[model samples]
Target: ETFVSRMNLESHPDQPEWLSHVNASVLKVKLAMAIIGISSIHLLKTFINAGNYDIKVLMWQTIIHVVFLMSALAIALTDRLLSATHAAAKAGH
Candidate 1:
């Protein structure tokens, strides 16, 4: 909103006043995902430092990878959904 105002750009007719709040929410979600990714990296590093090939260690590693992969897939799906919505809106349909 500030940038748009500063640039003297007109806002979209359909754009909600709450759009800034929505953007903040999206930023929070992205930050959380980033923290999760960083934590997963550290977790894997910790598992590696254990230097063990036991069943428990293997299970932990597999679980971590699965969780991270799922989160990534979820993010991708969400992005696609948002992109599609934006495209539809832009097409004025």
Candidate 2:
């Protein structure tokens, strides 16, 4: 409502509002997935490459990595879903 009521591009290519909305939705999802995937991979490689540590230290590091990965993944996915919901609602279909 705000976009339509406030952003009237009467002379710029005449693109439908839905196109802009869907593109924003896709961009958001892609940006989120990229960030999450890269971060997860980087963290995994960091732990994997940290070899030769003592058993106790390694176990602690593993536990920490698992907890962090799960937390980050859950938060990212939840946000992705919420963004999609907003994008769909904006489409007015």
Candidate 3:
């Protein structure tokens, strides 16, 4: 709903005044979380069927999962910092 509303507002010329204040970073964070969730599920499935996969494949999957986790953490941290900075700027004003 949030994304749909944002998209709708973006497509129209006469958007509400508050539309400018909407933080799109939240959506990015949510997407990052979803990617992490999907990566976790894939890793879990691979683990569950360990016998079907080679050890090298399992290791690679684990490495990929870790990379996804790190990427999500980086995105979340960046979003937090941006939000804090934005808030501080507003406070200064």
Candidate 4:
């Protein structure tokens, strides 16, 4: 791909890695997911108390939110498990 070729050419071969790559990628997803989760809670609450929105629309929205939020949750959960395993290996029990 063009993007990959450009990055490979630009990056120095001796470049030392930093934490930004992981932090930036993970935190971006985390923040997005947090926002989605809050929105889902708000939507569910509205449907519960107000009962003004159409049931079909609400159902669709809830399903979408669940799917999106689940994706974020899955990524975060996997990261945590991997980190735990890494720590355990480092600790060497």
Which has the greatest lDDT?
3
Ranking by lDDT: 3, 4, 1, 2
In candidate 1, stretches whose alpha carbon ends up further than 4 angstroms from where it belongs are 1-29, 52-54
lDDT (tens digit, per residue) of candidate 2 on 14-91: 767666556544665566566667766766776686675566766775676666667656766777888789799999
Top-TM-score candidate index: 3
Ranking by TM-score: 3, 4, 1, 2
The reply for model 3, stretches above 4 Å from the true place, is: 1-22
| Residue 41 error, candidate 2, Å | 11
Could you estimate the TM-score for every candidate?
A: 0.48, 0.42, 0.72, 0.51
TM-score of candidate 1 against the unseen true structure? 0.48
lDDT of each: 0.69, 0.66, 0.85, 0.74
Query: Where in model 2 is the C-alpha error above 4 Å?
Result: 1-52
Cα lDDT tens digits for candidate 3, 59-86: 9999988988898889889988988998
lDDT, model 1: 0.69
